[model samples]
Target: MKKSTLALISLLIVLCLLFVWAQNKILNYRTWFRVEEKILMISDRPEITKIAAMGFDGLVADLLWIRGIQYFGGNFSTLDKPEKRSGMMNLLRNLVGLDPHFLAAYQFGGFIINESIKDHEQAIDFLLDGADNNPLTEYPSAWRLPFDAGFIAFYQLKDHDVAKELFLQSIYGKKFAAVSVENAEGVKDDDSPEWLIDGDPFSSTRFDTSDGVFSLNLHDERQVGRVTVQQDSKRPKSYQLSYAADASMAAWQTLESVTNPGFYFHDFEPALKAHAFRFDQFKIQAEEDEEFSIAEVKIFGPRNPATPSYVERMAYEMDRAAGRFKAALDQYMRYYDEAVKKGDQVSADLSLQKLFDIYTNKCIEILQETAELYLQEKGSLPTAQMFELIQEGYLSRIIQQKITEEPGFVEDVAPVLMPTGNVWEILTTWDQKDPHLLITYTNDLGEEDWYITSRTRLIAEQKGVAEKLQQFVNKYKEEKGTLPENLSDLLNEPWFGATRIYEDPMGGEFFINRETGQVEARNPKY
Candidate 1:
């Protein structure tokens, strides 16, 4: 081989080595910059940052976000630090400003702002801004931004009115649809009767005077069974029920006569075969008032497919009451899935509440029962093994089994914000006195997650303690033939085998008000 060719090959090897060394030096320099303990101070002006990014604004914002997460994760500093939290918030705000369509950024950032920073106000602001800017075209039909805003309002701020309004807007968006009325434009004021289709029995529309006409238009004709009238206060002296084919004709067919008022069920003879009906004219003859108020007017036929079968709901309640937690949960799950599949948000919400009640209320009863049995048999407070046994065999089993089932179980467990129309106005009132329901929504790569609220867990523990205390009171009354003045009396009784009342699992003191027979927890942090 020629010496010149050998030298050329050696020179090629040298060039390759030089390239490798240069690449390693560049990587080492970048790593040094990445690890340096530099203070992170975010720009307050998002607009300025956007302008500086030029055409690659979104890409720049995303790169910054990745860097922020890495930095936040690397630093083991306390999240409670004001500066750290402020810097993170500022970073998130800028990222959102650059690309409002970045959903994951909003979700994760809101969670951190609320949980780590504990700045619920700023978190809510972030959610509202995202909701206003990113339309439904970019997200799910049930946009989560408003839903998150509602969560902050109710869970953190305890402002139900604001939460309710936010929830309604999230569900219905801008346009509202009528639930009962088919074509509202066709109905002329007082001339047309208010149609009450298949809805809640308790819901009703007022009928002005006893001597007034109420027209009815059935969606389909069927074998008529009975029409029930629910009055507001006073029952009319006498009322007549009639049916007609159309509004143009005057001759009405009498269904039945209701002499006494209150909830009058008028049954039709031979089952009238007509599509339209009317109150035809009636009188109250009340002493003081000239007009009578009717809460609801329900028209029941042979079989109305719209009406929910109470048999299933009642069966669930019965099974739950009988300590059949697994069966009851299964029943509730069935109804919940059915309602959600049909897009009946009202029924879905109702079934979801029932499921919650069983979990937080009925399940606690079983826990208390287990505790009572352990005390009776072992003559002491329950051990950790006993508690674990109850939890595994009962509580966890029921929930885990359902969660492991079909694909849509997770979504069904998490109630989506859907339009409820008239039901919204009726059910949206703030019931501050009742125990609040908290729902947390999260998505990881399109997989939804639902969890039992912390408040529910706390309430369940309290209810367990309260129920056991009630049993003690009842036993005292049985032995002494009278209610005790205080819980100390039960503890003092020797024959009662009274040990000590169980301490609240969620750090708090339970007290019974002797005057009211009411048990409540004091300083309940949960």
Candidate 2:
């Protein structure tokens, strides 16, 4: 080989080594600078950073996200400082602003804001922004933003109304079609019934009297399975719903006679096929001075063929939360009972209060679910009287009576009122003006304690009743030398009354399980 060629090759190798050394020095300098500064070295303003990216927003966002994660980890303990927290949040906002599709950044940033920075309002706002930017249709995971926002609003911020809206958004996500009202029966001046079908839940239509009626013309016969009614403060106390095949109003089939109808959504079973529907016999006033007002009305066609995965997930989460609360309630009740048996007055008192709180939570959860169901079935909100009947386990009986009272009622095929298996006597008072439910509980000291319901609580009274029944059953078995054939056999005993065993708050018979000697109900309400 020629000497000139060999020398050139050696020079090229030397130059490559020099470049590698320079790159390493530059990386070391960057690390040293970051450590010394101990601050984010990026523009806080999202717009400024986006402009600086110059069409490389996505790449810039990725780099910022990595930097955010590192910064958050490093300054996590010091996030209590306002400046540090604000800096972290600014970085997250900039990252998402640059790449709105950055799902992980939004979720993680929400966590940082809520858990680390302890800024619940900002966390909710950030998450809702994420939900807005990432449409669920385009990105299925976007539902998590609203779901998490609802969780924070409910559990952390204690804002149930906001939480409910967020949860509904997460579940439904604007899937329903708007219904139009072709005609109205009772139009009073400016308050027209067209507002009822205007697709705005907040706008209301007022009627002059209780005898007003609203009619709908579907143009073409369609099968509708659900009817949602949103009412203002002046709501109907009772109403009749019917459907007909034609506009002639002859041979109208009665759907239901709803009393104390709460506002929201109502669902019908066995979808009705008709071109015309009528909402009449509206007994709107409990007092002579009151007026009737309805916000919106919706008639839904058949549901979608497939349920969204997010909806399924929301249901699962609701059930899981209920289960967790139920378990906690059961444990606390056990503690209360043990304390009582041991004659620990102080402990018993504490446990009793705790039991009230826990049960109130559970009742709130059940009550919310019940209200939703009632709105679907009865097309109204539950009143104090309705809850009183439910607590006395007389709701089903009253419903049965109403059905039988109707003309041409059949005896054999009359629908049976099934036991809900729920033994919790939720003695609640609902006010239409207020969105909250007020629950009254009398403690052992004979003082009435009032509680505002929120989410989940325990059913201590139900468990107490079951426990008492089980004790009686055990006594009967011990005396008779075998399990009784039926719970009715215990009724013959002096202590066992027929009313105690037969009358259930949830409208079911309580029976003794012969095999386990355990007290069980005929049907499970939940």
The candidate that achieves the highest lDDT relative to the unseen native structure: 2
The positional error of residue 137 in candidate 1, measured at the CA in angstroms, is 4.6
**Model 1 whole-model lDDT (C-alpha atoms):** 0.56
TM-score of 1: 0.34
- lDDT of candidates 1 onward, in order: 0.56, 0.63
Worst lDDT run of 10 residues, candidate 1, spans 421-430
Against the hidden true structure, what lDDT does model 2 obtain?
0.63
Regions of candidate 1 where Cα sits further than 4 Å from its true position: 1-42, 75-77, 159-169, 174-526
RMSD from true fold, candidate 1: 22.5
Model 2 Cα lDDT, one tens digit per residue, 281-342: 76665655666777777676543323343442333234235443433443345556756877
TM-score of each: 0.34, 0.44
Off by over 4 Å in 2: 1-39, 174-204, 208-228, 232-260, 266-291, 296-526
